[model samples]
Target chain A: MILTVTLNAALDITYKVAALTPHTTHRVGEVVERPGGKGINVARVLAALGHECVVTGFAGGATGAVLRGMLAPLAPHDALVEIAGTTRRTIAVTDGTSGDTTQLNEPGPTVLPEEWTAFLSSYDSLLRDADAVALCGSLPPGIHVGAYAELVRRARARQVPVLLDTSGEPLRRGIAARPDLVKPNADELAQLTGSREPLRATRDARRRGAHTVVASLGPDGLLATTPDGTWQAAPPEPVRGNPTGAGDSAVAGLLSGLVAGLSWPERLSRAVALSTATVLATAAGEFDAAAYERLLGRVTVVEHTQAASGK
Target chain B: MILTVTLNAALDITYKVAALTPHTTHRVGEVVERPGGKGINVARVLAALGHECVVTGFAGGATGAVLRGMLAPLAPHDALVEIAGTTRRTIAVTDGTSGDTTQLNEPGPTVLPEEWTAFLSSYDSLLRDADAVALCGSLPPGIHVGAYAELVRRARARQVPVLLDTSGEPLRRGIAARPDLVKPNADELAQLTGSREPLRATRDARRRGAHTVVASLGPDGLLATTPDGTWQAAPPEPVRGNPTGAGDSAVAGLLSGLVAGLSWPERLSRAVALSTATVLATAAGEFDAAAYERLLGRVTVVEHTQAASGK
Candidate 1:
């Protein structure tokens, strides 16, 4: 079973409006609500892909209850911890005519010290049966900057592979704990490496103690490097729709591939295919089996060699 | 006892952010949740002022549960009927620097026919003991434009004074039912009357079956035309601060004063005073008793003869 942690879960609300004009009242034509957060997104996609996954995180207040209820229909298993403050909501206002989206995210509720302790205590037991752990999204307020690092350390102690996906200070701090894999988008990679070049940034991320670095370049496809091999995987064609949770979908694909004992090239191909399929799906981070199967054959994986491949 | 009906109740969520940029994600500094709808806002303020009020409406799903939980702390009685769909949420993002607010309102869940029947049945029983009833806010989807008209007719059957506050078609349809009172802001009044002139529009509103028309003009204060007289009540001085729910607060004040057997002038003065105090207070729709007491003495009530009121 895969264990996913979303420190800052949200109730994702999509509102369809004729148009959005600043400082004016708008009557929404449609509203759709779902569970949200990078980890939650990853877990949702994994469940849709027929994977066994357990989601554990801090949920609180009324918004948290709504978030959990939304998750009930999507995820396979739930072990979310109850906290004091309510979870936040992220609003996506889409223009019905133009299809352009304006997103407003609420900063999730703060996590107190005792809540963190409770989560870690419960997570230790959850990790014992988990094949891999994925720590995803931004940490809520009051959590230590190195909170993900502690999770990575715990995963290592349990001898379970861990995937880290986040940005900024938390990502930087979590990398030093040497998670099995870290996936950062182009901009996050640049911030970490202080370089615009993807190849250089990927290498820099690996040098920061990540065993493997997967750099997701939107539309351009996925770039990954490991101690044994380096590869670039690209879909034959770009599929366009909503790219909101494409990265999380890719993380789900990669974890599913790893658990299936697929080769690195096959894993990269699966990740690229699933991410592309997610974009083509009606909702973000959700890929139907038919879409995934249709896109699988079109993904092309190319191998690259490092100067010091053995290291 | 006062009965307030919020056909489309919502879980009002507020997020305090440093600033809001369209399409960008933000971490909220603070979060607050309250039960919201115009009538719920009125009920909260009335309850805070120590009035016996019963809140009734259609509530459903997890979001509805959250709304009810939040309302539990504010209202004296609850007669919410369970519906098929969850309640909606309204998000207010406040910019910490300039204090400018950006609002995003969700289109509330559709009220099924069974839910409407349930609510009307419950409302019928509650109306038996109600001295006054307030029909407020927009009609939720799936309900007819004349839903409030039916509610007003029911309230009138019990000889209860009904205050109808809504906008556009609902307000237009509701007025034909001959509600005792109708309160519209400047914009809603103009839309209903097709006249931009406040006095003319308010008088026009009164001519269309409403015994009394009260128009709230924000900083311009309250304008009312009853059978006894036409009066414009303004605060002695402009009280400046947040005006988020000053109109609803005024409605609460008017109802509270009327229930206490105050005269029209006294009710109008108290409405203006409470509204001014609410604007002066830090929280939306909340007025400090001391500030309200001080402002009451400073409200200026000006009487206008119908002949002179014609522009």
Candidate 2:
């Protein structure tokens, strides 16, 4: 079973309004809610791919209950440790006219020290049956900055491959722990490597210690530098809808492929297709299965053999 | 005991952001949650004045649970009915830069036939001990348009004074049932009577069926046409802040003053002061007690002798 951790989970809410005008009241036309957080999102994608996955993290208070309640029927098994603070919420107001989205994100509840320790115990127990573990999203307040690094080290100790997906100091620290893989979007890569070039940034990120680095380039596609070689994968066309969960979908693809022992080229193809399909899907954290299937064979994966030259 | 029915109760959530910009993501700086809806707000204000108030409404699901949990410690008694549908949430995004608020209101849960029937039974039981009842706010989906009218008639039958506060068709239909009082803002008064003139509109509204008509003019204060006489009450100075719950505070002032056997002029004075104080308060459904006291003696109430022509 694949294991995913989301320390700062959320109840993702979408409000559909005729128009989002500042300084005025609006009666939302529709409300769509879903369980959200990076690792939860990745778990959802993996579950959609018919993989048995377990989601373990910190779930607390009313919003956390709502998120967990919504997740109960899904494929991923819930192993979340209880906490005292309520989970946060993320609201996206979609405008009918301009089709633009205005987002409001509430900070997650601060995890107590005891809560963090409880989560570590749960994670260790879950890792016992896990082939791969993923530590995803921002660290909720009260957790140590190197929380992901500790988790990565633990997973490596258990001989379970781990993927770290985060940003800022956590990413910097977690990457140094030499996780099996790290997926950072272009902006996050730039922040980490101080370089805007995807290929150079991915290489710089790998040198920071992950066994492999994958950079999601939004609409363009994925750039990866693995131990065996390097490859750039692009979709047949850019699919534009909501790019909210595209990166998590790519993470799911790569992690699932890694566990399935698929070739690196095949994994990149799957990752690219899944990422594009997620952007094309209407719902958050969901990929249009047919779109993924259609784009699968069409995804282009080109390998760069000049790895030693650092080009 | 005073009873307030918020057929469509809400979990009012306020988010403070640095600035409200359309089509951009915002990190909320602070989050405040309160039990809300017209009658709920009124109940909150009444409780603050040491009035024993009972709040009855449809509450369900996780959001409802949160609302109830928060309301548990408040002064008012909770006798809210349970339903299968989740209660709604209203988010007010206050911009720190401009201090302008943007609101997004979610439609309340659809009350089923059985749910409405259950609520009526609860209302009937509560009315047994109720000296007066206030039916406030919109009718949620699945509830009949004449729901408030029916409640008003029941309260009247029980010899319990009923105050109707709503807008559009609900107000129109409710008025014909002869509620003891109706408090509409300037916009609602104009909509009900097709007159922009407050005196004429208040009289017209009273003629439709309410024994007393009180129209709250934003910043300008209130105009009341009661059986004893007609009076216009204005604050000494306009206190500006958020007007979100000003009308509800007015309803609370009027209702509590009625129970206290205050005269028309005195009740109007209290209502105006409370309304203004609510606007000056920092939190939702709260009035500045000191400001209310300060503004009470300073409120100016002018009685118009030409009541017949409403000149």
Indicate which candidate wins on DockQ.
2
> Per-prediction fnat values?
0.50, 0.94
Expressed as tens digits, the lDDT of each residue in A1-311 for candidate 2 is 99999999888999999998888889999999999999999999999998999998888899988898999999999998889998999999999887789999999899999888888888898999999999999998899999999999999999999999999999999999999999999999999999998888999999999999999998778989999889989998766688889999999999889999999999999999998999899786699999999999999888887855466
How much RMSD separates candidate 1 from the native structure? 2.6
Ten-residue region with minimum lDDT total, candidate 2 chain A: A302-311
Q: Candidate 2: deviation at residue A224, Å? A: 0.7
lDDT of 2 by residue, B228-255 (tens): 8888999998676888889999999999
Q: Give the B-chain TM-score of model 1.
A: 0.97
CA deviation > 4 Å runs, candidate 2: A307-311, B307-311
lDDT (Cα, tens digit) per residue for candidate 1, span B1-311? 89999999888877788876755566667777788898888888888888899998888888798888777766558788888887887877788998878777878888889889888889999988998999999888899999989999999998999999999999999999999999899999999999988888988998888999999999989999888888999999877798988988888888988789898889999999888888988876577678898988889999997578753
Q: Tell me the number of clashing residue pairs for each predicted model.
A: 1, 0
Give the clashing residue pairs of candidate 2, or none: none
lDDT of candidate 1 vs native? 0.87
